[model samples]
Target: MTLPDPADQADNPVGGVRTTSTVSAPTARAAWSITFLVMILQTVNFADKAVLGIVARPLSEDLGLSNADIGLLGSVFYVLFVITGLAGGFIADRVRIVWVLLGMALLWSLVQIPVLLVGTFTALIISRVLLGAAEGPAGALNNVAVFGWFPKSKRGLPSAVVTSGTSLSKILVAPALTVIVAAYGWKAAFWTLMIVGLVWAAVWLVVGKDGPYSVNSARERAKAGSAGKVERVGFLRIAALPTFWGGVLGMFALYGMVAVILTWLPSYFEQGLGLSRVNSGLLFALPSVTGMASMLLVSFLTDRLVGRGMTVRISRGMVSVVALFVCGGMLAALPLVDSAWLAVFLVVAGYGVGVASYPLMNVTVAHVSPERQVASTLGVFTALFSTSGILAPWLTGRLVDAATTPAEGYTTAFQIFGVVAIIGAVVMALTVNPERDRARIAAIDPLACADSSADDKY
Candidate 1:
């Protein structure tokens, strides 16, 4: 059998494959620019989602929403978001992502406007539903664009940069929107995010582009028509793989924790800890600051280690498993802490440590996937993992409603999900062997894996 190109060995220590030669300075600049914009765009994307949770308390009062109602409100966005994401990923695989991103950003921004004007529970629901639909494809597409710009070996930082937006948005949105909501009311917060979306869209229209890799990938797909087409690993086959399931399960647990935090953290502070809204916002942003640092550190370290010839399993997989366990423990200890500062420290530290896994997980999926299926596979991952958003918000709300005290509700919710995180960590640690999965995928898609080594027995 022909050996995989030595060039393919460079990008990732384990299974990564990049279709480009050594990057030129100008190309590197462009790639980094794209990475920066992706980070900003993700910041905007999450800001939109998080704004609702930030405003949830006041919005509930203005419209007479119960905890259950609030839960439903948060869940509405994912209803169509997931469905549209499925279609959107298929489209991204076949087309330029630049326009798709622009259109979605514009629509989500416009959707925010009606909520500010109409100011009703139904209006909020409609706005969130539309926003959700528009943003559904955002995660998959954004990552596709980012990955296109950089090689697999260099992906960790960019991936982390993009994923960091979720945490970064917490840093910015929580404090800024808190002040806005406090001063001008919750509607102002909506208006602020709308402007943010519109501005981000405008900037993206100027700077946004699908990188050369994406262009080349699309051309390859076009040329592979009919007879030249390679049979890809089936969706079910992909789903059945240990790597995929582990990633999905692990992400599900972590994301569930994230959802609960975004939707209820402020409420917890206000109702459970007896903190003021501003203080809650400040505290919320605090953990995210730590998260931002942790994100960058983890990504940088992964790349450095991989470059130094460490196994991907050690550099990426083990790191993530440890972070998950640490995060889970911190969360489980959250309800046990009585001091306000201790509670804040625990929550913040948990989220910060948890973020270390985001980029590693995304890179793992890419390293093990067929080149043409990257976007679609990521969409599938997103779809599966995003179920956490649906279950977490609704369940937390239900729990809170069932409890006599909001503190009890919040405590019970944290402890339960904490266990989930640990379970996911254990499964992921055992199952996500990148080397094994890479070989399995290569066996069925030789053409797709041409750039990848086929001789490694690991």
Candidate 2:
């Protein structure tokens, strides 16, 4: 048997329905509905990943886990995270994304149950592995689904809203889960996460469905009457793009910085700074709240600028470049402060400004790739960045273990990654010229620029 070309399938609907138009109220409503659901699920997803970090101390003491063991536990999740994400990207393009999301949510909830029941390092390891596999594709695919709802120029704010869930979960989930862990045990926190996952799955089943505009760039172009034929560009060509390379390095730096903060922040406060658990939790929420506000503001500004006919390089790329530099500066100062409160403030500011670039990174890749290829492009993007997830936990663990004090180890880690982030910012500023890249992408395949001339109703 032979498989169908995704490019062809994107252009030619099987049911002969006209679903790719911007002039419909019903479609707009559905798009918003799906975007809202994506936000909720994404929040829950981050919450699930975060629970382990929140409980890391207690779990380590309870299970008698060494620093290396904890590092292995964190690293184990990414063992499958990268491979599944690559496959998930392809599956997302070829299959119904609704079912993909549903299945992943279901599996994630089920896997968490085993850890709560067994409550051992082995069981916890197993749970993390399975959950990682389930979540690997989620980030990329959810963005793909969200992007399907809006036209190219209108994607920034919606994408920011989705990405903001990561920060929002820290705000909402952190304090609550911390209390749950304090009152009950780390096991109870796992149970709460499981329940949240199940609830999100139920809501998704009732309301989730793919958007009509889920077709690729070629089909979108045909709809706009800008092109007469569809084209399929290879991954090699996309890989050669400067925008791609810049996104690769910049996203890796950004994700690594965020991952370090998320996985180690609580530990840093409790173990390094001698804060109470509740105080640590409350402090952890600060950066996320700041991040939530910053992301929304930056994304909205980028969208408004784009709508006003600003080139994406100036509107989105430069904004991210500036934010990255700010993030690096803050991280570099985090360990330099004499006061604990000042240190917290610096770290929070770092996380806040660093994440301001998240949504723009998604938009940057979308701007330079075809619509059909966006998910795969983002999947590869997420997978590459996700290595930070592996490295942050394990490397921080090792550095701390090797140090004379936890504070010194953490200080070293922060300074090193801070420098790396500034370098990434430099690369982004130098390499990503979105105006030139967009035109180059259009030359490679005109469909990538579909409806660019369409009046901005959004």
Candidate 3:
């Protein structure tokens, strides 16, 4: 149950740089335990997101709100998302990540109380804004935490596993929350989530600690003169790379579709497709189930490819290109289909295939970034792409409002997402050269590319 000592490991190469090696079997089990915990953490984080969408219809009805108003409510959550994601990244880099995660979880629970107590539009806005801010860094931090337990070559699967937590939330918790909303009403769903967040926070507080591969652990090694320090580079240097921006752009498009799904997919199923609330909720979860399977498959293949000596351009970059392209094509075809079943298939296959790019893009960025700047780089990356959260939902709302029919509006929105995904795929194809970017980083700051083993000592 105890974490393995990094001092027991030998030198290892990670992402083209020498670093501390892998843990023993028992240590790896402990690491995997941490990974599983963070995966659950991600589950809770996404459950918070999916709840608003599950209750969107009922809440809008209760508030007597228009489509535009509902969309604005969804958009408001991300008003503070980008800013907090950036700030949280810097904070995580400086502070103990365990503490940062703890603080965020506690805040998530507190934010829900606003909606529970007031049940007003203004109160809902307040809750969404606060919750968005708290959860903004969750994605980046979750990746960083899980990465701390694994070496570069083995990171893809864990990253996918962590990101799949969102899929898990949609597939499992969303349906359950839908029932809760059905039985107890929208405010009751908020109350339930608040309790869930609190319970998770309590568990995390007891079990959470930095992994052996964490910056905190590295700093301890440096203090003991057992590890050589990797010089920290300015954020700008890391940001300037094409790999960074390309990955960001790809993720931006993908996450935009994700935002639309989380905020509007259930509504689409209910209103656009003419499904019952329960059925809509179930259908709402279908894409995520496919998405989860796709991500795991892609990650497993990607890790295997990397392990087999394939270049990242082929393993990570090309995989993203293919997935995004498939997603785009499926989405574009959605409006063209006549049957509801066909439309559902397009959605499931499109979104499911498209989301696999998320883990690959994350690993690509992490691979190219200076180890010391990974947190900040990831923070900035998350912040930039997350702007889509603000735009996608609001824009979809406006589009739907402008359309003559609900189905027309929803299909138009899906088409736009399709186009964006295609563009992202092209960009990723052109720019996601992890080996080249790694070399570029090393050339810019040689010390940053030095062996990480000095920092790897537990």
Candidate 4:
């Protein structure tokens, strides 16, 4: 079947429903219910994939593997994640959000069954690849589905909430896995995911839809908004955007580090730091806790500061600089610590600060792209971010394999990675020539006129 024109960014979703604009209180409430349901699917996407890494502690011991081998397993996921993510944005441009998300959710989660039989490295590698492939679409497609509901002005918190699901998963997964792995063994964890997956599939069926309320719902609202809203943003144009590139590089640096930790850190704590499984998880989960805090606070701070007349660049920079500095200091200090616990503390602290940028594009896409194209714009953002995932884990693996000790591996690797984060910090700190892009965007506004289906309420 022919797909929707990839360049079309009308407010109408793949299902032909216009999913933007105000609606009746009851309908609006219904819309929120759907949006939050999507959040649950996304939470599963994060929690399932992340919880795997925590289980690596037990899984490795069961299989008698080294940190480097486990790192390879993580690398497999990134590789497949890149493959799926590479085209997820374009697919979002053409496909219905619900169908794509549902199919992918079921497809990826089914792969977890193989982990129960993971006695060999090759078998585990295949499972990770399947997991990555599943994850790729969920992150990118969920963004498209989400941005369709909220207006540009209100996107900050909602976007953060969706993105924060990953953190929420991290907080819950660490300790939970510690217990599950101890009692039922690694096999039990995958079985738990299997059950959750089926339940989530049911939730998506009931609550998932085009959006909170659509253009039709708008005229039904207490506050009737404007009329005749439309949008059209395409890959060709998004590729030329300077801010898009900035987000690409910035998101890459941030996620590459995260992929590194998710795959390698558990092994690092066990071998390099000499901690028990529970203590090691608690120590490792520190960054996620900090990340959760930043996810909420930074959005409010960015939106508030920018509203008070700060340039977009300056507003974004405020969080980036301080966060990166904290990240850098912690990373640099981690290897120097004599105590393993001290090292764990420093690493998590630095990582927490660095990762505040994880949700940066959620806001940037809302502002820089056409309202209707929020999902497609975010798809590219996630695509680029996943590309970084492809490389960072492998590179971390190579580094760990090369080093005699986990401390040396992380130290040298993070030193280089910290420099990369600093470069992003400098870029965010500098003011973008908004005038340059403003004119470029203005020149394209005429073409945007052709997108008569655009919904301006978003």
Writing each residue's lDDT as its tens digit, candidate 4 over 286-387 gives 777887788768877776765566655555544665676567667755556788767767777777777776555556544565434545666667777677
How accurate locally is residue 26 in candidate 1, as Cα lDDT from 0 to 100? Answer: 35
Indicate the worst ten consecutive residues by lDDT in candidate 1.
1-10
Best by lDDT: 3
| Steric collisions counted per model | 1, 0, 2, 4
Q: Which stretches of candidate 1 lie over 4 Å from their true place?
A: 1-25, 215-231, 451-458
Query: For each candidate, what is the lDDT?
Result: 0.78, 0.77, 0.82, 0.63
- What are the runs in model 3 whose C-alpha is more than 4 Å off? 1-26, 222-230, 453-458
Clashes of 3: 2
User: Candidate 3, 263: how far from true, in Å?
Assistant: 0.7
Segments in model 4 whose C-alpha atoms lie over 4 Å from true places: 1-32, 117-119, 212-234, 306-310, 430-439, 447-458
**Model 3 per-residue lDDT tens digits across residues 153-261:** 7789999999999899999889898888899898887887788888888998888888766756545544354355435677887888888998889888888888889
Residue pairs clashing, model 3: 227-454, 228-454
lDDT of 2 at 74: 73
The TM-score, computed over Cα atoms with residue i paired to residue i, of candidate 4 is 0.83
Which candidate would rank higher by lDDT, 1 or 3?
A: 3
Candidate 2 lDDT tens digits, 36-77: 899888888888777767888888889888766776777777
Q: After superposition, how far is residue 234 of candidate 3 from its true place, in Å?
A: 1.1
